[model samples]
Every structure is written in C-alpha cells, then in structure tokens.
Target: MNSGLNFLQTNVNKDFTTLKKNLKKDFTGLKKIKVALLGDSATQFLNQALRACAYEQGFEFEIYEADYNQVSRQLLDLSSDLYQFAPEFVIVFESTQKLQHKFNSLQKSERLQLSELKTEEVKNYYHTLNRQLKAKLIYFNFSEPMDGQFGNYSNKTSFSFLYQVRKLNLELMNLSQECKNLFILDYQALSAHLGRQMAFDAKMFYGASMNLSIDGLPLVAKNCCDIISAINGKFKKCLILDLDNTMWGGIIGDDGIENIEVGDLGNGKAFSDLQQWARQLKQRGIILAVCSKNDEQTAKEPFLKHPEMVLRLDDIAVFVANWNNKADNIRYIQSILNIGFDAMVFLDDNPFERNLVRTNLPEVEVPELPEDPSMYLEYLSALNLFETASYSEEDELRNKHYQQEAGRVIAQKNFTNEDDFLKSLGMTSKVEPVNKFNLPRVAQLSQRSNQFNLRTVRYTEEDVLQISQSENYFTLTFDLKDKFGDNGLICVVVLKKEVSALFIETWLMSCRVLKRGMENFTLNTIVEVAKKNNFKKIQGEYLATSKNGMVKEHYARLGFSEAGQLWELNIENYQTKKSFIQLN
Candidate 1:
C-alpha cells in the first residue's frame, strides 16, 4: 500500500477495475475533503471513480452527489443539499451531448447565439455558487463534436455546432480568467488525447445517458483529482535530469561534444525536443537541477559548447555531477532546495539508477523511461506531473533566487561569527498590507509553503482577496532584499481580531529565507500591530502536518506561553526581538 506521495513515483496501475479495488482499502488517517459533484448526465460511475482515484492520491473524499440534471437547482437555491453539505470543491460536469441537444433546439438565429448564451449560463452558475459558498468551482469544458452539417465549411460560420463548441471553449477560458474562483477542466483536451471512439461509448450513452465510457471514467476521475491535489499544494516543484543518454543521446565522455546526438545529429531531434520542453518548464517557474553520475567537467561540456543544446548552465539552480551514487547526489540537491522529496521529480534513462532512487527516496517521483528515446517526452507529458494552482511574475525569477542563495551559502563558510555574517549581508525587508499588487504571490505562498507554516491552511487567490478587503482581518506581507539579490515576498501573516485579542490565522514563510532571523522580524511586526491597535493579547496555534514538523515548537521558542491548546503573549509584557534585517 503506497502512500499518496509515493503513488506517482512509480507507474502504478490506473486500470478502472484496479482503481475500484482501492475503494475497499483502509482509508484511515487520510486527509478528508468534501466534494460536491453535479452533472446533467448520470454521474454514479464518475462519482465512484473519483472516490477511488482520490484514495490512491491519499485523500478520502466525502462526496455529495446531486441527482441527475440538478445543476441549476443545486446552484441557484441557497438551502439545497449542496449548500447544506458545504463542500470545499464543487465539480460541474456538463456533457457535450446535452450541450448539443440544447443547441439543436434553438432557432437558426438563436443557434448563432448558442455559445454566448451557454457561456453566460455557466458564468451565472459560477457567480451564484461563489456568492453562497466559498467552494472552488471546477467546470468541465465541452469536447468538440463534429455534427457534419456544415462539414469543412463550419470554420467559416458561427452558427455551426463545431464552430460554436470551439467558441464556447474559448469563452470558458476567458470567463475562468475573469473569475478567480472558477477553474476550467480541460475535458476537450482529455477527449482528444484519448480519441473520440475510446472516450465516448454510443451504446452506453443510448442506454444509460453515460457520456464517458467505462474505460475512460478512471482517466477523467484522475484528471479531476490532479486539479484538486494541486489546489491543496501537493504539486511538483522541481525536475532533476540525468545527463548521458537522458538529456542527449550517447555518453558525453565517450562520444564527445561534437559527436553527441543533438541538433541534426543521429536521433538528435528527440533529445532536442525534450530539452526544449524542459526549458519551457523552467521559464514557468519549475526549478531544474542536474544529478548525473559523471565527472563534473565532462557532464557540463555539452551544455557549454554544444550549439544544439536547448538548456544552458544558468537555467539549472543546482547541478551535481560527481562519481557518487545518484541517490546521495539527489539528497544533496534536496538539501539545497529545502523542499520535501515528494516535491521533486527525477528523470533518468538507467533502470538501475531509477530503482535505486525509488527504493531509497520513495517520496521522490521517478518516472519509468521508455526504451525508445522517441517515446520519452510523450510518456512524461501524459503523466501531468507539474500541475499548478496559481502563477505569478515572481515564479519566473525563482531560478535566479536559488542561484543567489548558493552565493550566500559560499559566503557563510568564510565567516566564523554568526552575528557578523548576518550583519555583513545588509538585509532589508519591506512590510506592507496585502494589496492587488502582491495578492497572487501571497496566495501562492499560502499554498506552496509547508515546512515553515505554523498552520497549513491553503488559500486560493479569491480567498486571499476577500480576506484582504475584510475589516476583521489584518494581513502583512514581507519582501526581503540583501546585497546578493531580492527574495520576493518571503513571508505572510494573517491575524483576526476578536475583542481585545488578535488571533493568528496564518503565519507561513518561504524556506529559502529561513534562519536569517526573519521569524523574529515577523514576530516583532506582529507585536507592533497588536500594540498599535490596543489589543491586550495575541494568540497563535501550531497545527501539525506530515511536512510541518520543523515548526512544532515555534511558538515556544518565540517566548509565547502555552495557554491550554493555544499559545498566548500579553502585548504589554512582550519586548521587541533583535533582528539583523532592517525595515525599509
């Protein structure tokens, strides 16, 4: 029985029957989440598949499945079962078959307005549900259907079903961007990936109004679970690559840089394509690292000299190329990253190396490389390992941030006194309330920060925005900069006012800025806020999770006295803590 974190490390069975068997397994101790599933078509199979797939991902979903064709009623009525259940995620799966039926009933003039009307309907559903509940909306986009009425000419007309479906998909994307709580599930892409014949069963639809075939239910369920897991902050953040034969064809030492199969060389296109894909991932904020079992100079030769290489040295945050075991090298990389093993993915061509890493670091995701180099990218892409819930401008600069941290590490070795080293850095921090400018990064940190987080409460951008506008809540964001480089938005604190006391709702900081006395600076700021507002006391709590054990004694170490299950500090008794970081 693999834990949720280890399931993706190997190519575990995803067969529908196999997933169904997971329902019988012990679900004790799994993280419980509430989900409400509403579909126009029959959703019994989808509901079952979702529960089973969620079990494999280490979640026990308490699902509230609405009766068939109850999407509108469940969403519009505030006192409905959906509202009563108060689910964390509300999935709206509207079948394309049902959409086509609605389109066919419209007059020819109304047919031209089908996409617009349907988009508005979905927008209404989202807004109504959002106003009533804080649950995130996961709506499925329609898969394209070729009605053959206009044949190839449908591209020229807006009234055609094919044209309308494509327009509806685009409209849904636009709507999702406008509405922060709304998320569009790419059902169209999934159907295209599995092909029409396999995705939809005509006989099953005719008999039982099942839009998805039995074979495809597990995949659809898995996709839904992936989005949910990502929203909960369990997504991959790093990609570790092997150099010889994995990044390029042939051994770098034996084949030489010029003879390496990259660019227009032998079987070079596949390797080049993989590198291009990796570069795109890096640009999107996924940290890239190298863990190769070779001489450092030899492993770096191709990246430095090979013109066909898509990846450059600057693209990698940590590069470990030595004659040591790959597992130890990966562990070293993890240390520099300061992230959990579950957040990293290691790609290698050698089965022995992959197995060794899997056996030792079971939490690290290790995908099985196909025998043929041509199939590598295709297989990895299908896994969808890098699903993310949010993106910000700060993400693009993550590589540079890590590279600067490396410089700090080397500089620390030269100084003996910790105080002198800290003062030498000349660190400055800018503290401000949450606003439109930094809301995305604040919400992203809330989801991504785990180890240093006192209470692991994940929040979406919508949730953060609402809290920012509430008078009952006080928010603070910290931006750190030193002589080396800027570590953008390193810490966030949220406090809720209750009579004469301020309760700390959230206190999470990036692991990158840990041990720099940032925690003291943050606490000093929190105390300042409490005193300025005339609050008599401040209260905080530490909620333990599998990954946040590092901060279990955080309150105790910060001079907070234990009060029942909570930590408390009287504002009058609190003294300002000293920190090297100056407020800017």
Candidate 2:
C-alpha cells in the first residue's frame, strides 16, 4: 500500500468525529429529500453519518428512523408508520447476526426451508412497498460471519447456516433484476474492502448490537452518499489526467517517450493498468481529457508512438497540453465539453498541482494520489468514484460520437448562414413513444440529466415503465441523427392527460443536442399528441433551478402564455411551430 492512501484511511477517524459534531443544521440551496432508515440493529451512528454525508453533498435530508428490530413489523403492515412517512427513499440494513441467530435456532432438517421462507417474505415486502409507495428501495446484503464452525467446508455445505446467508445474498441480487426499483447495497463488498477484522467490533456487537465498528461508519456513510448522489444525477462525468509521472513512472518531458516507464515490466504495469481502467471508463460514456504541463507535441508523442499505451488520441475527447496553469486549462476543457466543474475529476501525481487545482476550482474532485505507482489501481478501485445509476447501449459509443460532434463544430465555420449550416448537416429526428426497447435509456435521461431538465424530477426504470404502460399517459423519446453522427435517445418527455388538458410531467434533453431545434421539434410533437387525444389545452411548466437557469424561459420562447406557475396554450388556438429537423 502507498503511504498516502494508508495515511488517509487510517487518520480520518478524527475528521469524521468533527463532522458528526457539526451536523446540526442543513446547508442552504439544497433540495429537501425525505428518507426512512429501517434496520434490525442499533443504527443511530449510521443515521448520523448519513446525515453528515448528505449535508456535505448538498442534500437537506429529513430522515424517519424506525426503532431497532422493527424491520418485519414496519414492512409487513400496510398501515405502518414507514408507509405513512411517504419517504422518497427507503434504506434497509438488516444485521447478519440476526440472520445467523434464526438459522442457528432452526433444526438441521428445517434450515433450507427457513432460508426459502425468509427470502419469500423479503420479496413480498419489497413488492408491497413498490405497490403502496413511490419510494426507491436500498436493501443491504448480509456480511459474512467472522468464524464458521465448519471452517473451510462452510461454503461447500449446502444446508449450513453460513451457506444460507450466502444464498440469501445471491437471491437478492437475482431478484433485483426483476424488481426495477430495488437496488442492492453491497455491504459485503464494503466489509471485504475494509477487512472483516476492522469492520466488525466484537465488543460493540455484544454490548450494543452494532453491526459496524465506530470507525467503519464514515466509510459506510460515504458509500451511501455515493449512491444517493448518483441517483440524483450529481455524479462525476469526466476525468482529467496529468501525464508524465502521473500516467507513467517518469517525467515524459525529461525521459522522452522511449524511457517513460509504462509497459508490462516492474513499475510499468501500474501505469498500464491505470490506462486500461481509463479506457474502460471512456467506453462507458465518461469523457477523458489530458491536461499536462508539457508541450502539446511532446505529450502527443507517447500516445502516438508508445507500443503499450492503452489510451490513444481518439479515446480523448479534449486534449490540452500546455505550460499554463492546470486550473486554467481545466476550465478550457470544461468549455469544450459543456459540463460543470463539479462533474470533473482531476488526477495528478504532484501534490502542489493537485492542491493548486483544488484551491482554484473547489468543485473539481482532486483525489490524493498514492506515491507508489503500484498502488494506483487498487486504491482507485476502493474509492468507487465512477458509480453509475443506469446504463444503455449508446454509452459504449459515446467517445466516438463526441469526436464527430467536434468535427461538426469545425464544419460550421465553413458556412456563414446559421440556417444553411443546420440544413447542410441533414439533421433528422425519430419521435416515438417509449417502449420496452428504449425504456432503459429513457429512465437514464431522467436520472442523469440536470441542466437540461425542467422541474428536475427523477424517476426509476419501474416508474417509467408504469408511465409508458398507462392509458392516460404519453411518453415521448427523441433520437437525433445529423451528417456528423447519430446521437441516440437524446430527449425524453412525459405527458399526463387530465379531463380537458395534457400536463407535461417531464421535459429533459441531452446538452449535446441543444441549439439544434430539438426543443422546437419536441414542442410541435407535444401539441400534436394533445390534438390527437382531443385535449383542449396543452400545459407545461418551468421550474427554476441553479443548474437549469438556461431553460427558465423555455415555455415563453415557444409562445406559451404564462398562467401563474404554469404555462398553457389552447389546442385550437396553438399555431404549429416550424423546425429544420425532419421528424419521423
């Protein structure tokens, strides 16, 4: 292990203590979100850590915590307080000790039956909650026991108590595929990362029935915050890497491309692994950019000529290699990408450079890099910085698609007239209702799109599926293609039909398709849907958010008259809007 990460994981106990002391009031400008925590063991410390973590990430949390050992009662009863709380999120963290106690008390012949019954009860509870409330569920899996009586044979024995716990965890994972709103919190993974000895304190477990040690609370809380942030569309989308000693073993400017240590030998393997990891992220829609303190030509040599380089020029969306300050360079990269500073992660080997960027751009995440190159991959994997809430097929080709977008920008300079430029691109759109094939992408747009999202409401895949299947609701998904490339599944709009009006429930689009008349095309489609359904009025709304200020005047720009907080256009009086996009 590197000294830097070792120091960080070991010395953060004091910081967490200070954090718990200062968790009295919520921060300003954060959205108020309600949550309920139901667990089998004492969970006051976990709740405290959750609040502190949530507040740090700009969330004003109103938590409803049920008493210990109330999981079964709160879940089974329809009129329970858990349902009455009407939480937006429900977190369940049942203790492994309780599961083991039940298994140990059962006779040998009844062990397998007990596991089956417990799994069925859990599934029923989830189904009941899904039917009764709109809240998203976060259920934790069981942790392994410290010691099993059968020792090495415990996993091999099918009817053993330890074996049943493993079976239950696997069953939960498989069940999540069927339950769209159910997300499994991998507590066992966290326990393994921190080591079982450090995660479980026997004295605390015996005295107070605490599942995790006091020092382990902060890490667990951090993982919980990562999940919450990703669900709310606040996770990082870009990674800015520094070359030379950072991506390799030596300074590229001094050692030249041939001498830089990045191959399959010795310390080189670490940098090679790091590059492979970055390449995988690129394939999954995370933008990669290079910001190094070397000449542009010099930095290009390694990616161009190195035999073992996993990342090439085509993989990088933006490359800014100059002697200028890194903070300034990162701002330039953000401009080209059109993303917020909070969505970028800066990785540099120099402590001074990392501190410089952190001071200048406080929103950017600057992780403390380990001094030893060999520890880079392991340390980063433990952090889980790129956790995602959803995925789609389009994500795999995101890097190539963005490269084509850059080409379009250059092509635009060749034409003086804006309309001629747009026409030259041969832009076409396919407007269709959301179906089983496009359900995942539609839900992802709702979860990850913030700046282009009006009203900023989030929905799970299950919620979107229900909306699509409803008779009175209309779900629209837009796909865009131009001369440059295909931008797949770029926009999503949900409309709910009332007695005489069709109300817009969601209006979100990808930033990449902005200023291309997609919004105008979408409005025309909305009116068409309303006319076909025999609705009298088409109603919309624009909720102002710090990130969505660009769209505050969206309805007004589309000629909809404002009626207090709502915008409305009478279907008979509405005029069709013209657009260059050919709709299918």
Best by TM-score: 1
In candidate 1, what are the lDDT values of residues 1-584, reduced to their tens digit? 22421333234337678789989999999999999999998899999999999997789999999998999999999899999999999999998999888988999899999889999999999999999888999999999987678888999988889999999999999999888888888999988866687678999999998888876777789889999998998999999999889999999888888888988999999999999989999999999999998889999988898889999999999999998999999999999989999999999999999999999999999988878898788778878889889999999999889999999999999999988999999999999999999999999999999999999989899999999999999999999999999999999999999986899999999999988999999999999999999998999999999999999999999989999989998879778898999999
Q: Which stretches of candidate 1 lie over 4 Å from their true place?
A: 1-13
In model 2, what is the error at residue 539, expressed in angstroms?
1.0
Q: Estimate each model's TM-score.
A: 0.97, 0.96
Stretches off by above 4 angstroms in model 2 are 1-15, 113-115
The backbone clash count of each candidate, in order, is 0, 0
lDDT of 1: 0.91
What are the RMSD figures for all models against the true structure? 3.4, 2.0
Worst 10-residue stretch by lDDT in candidate 1? 1-10
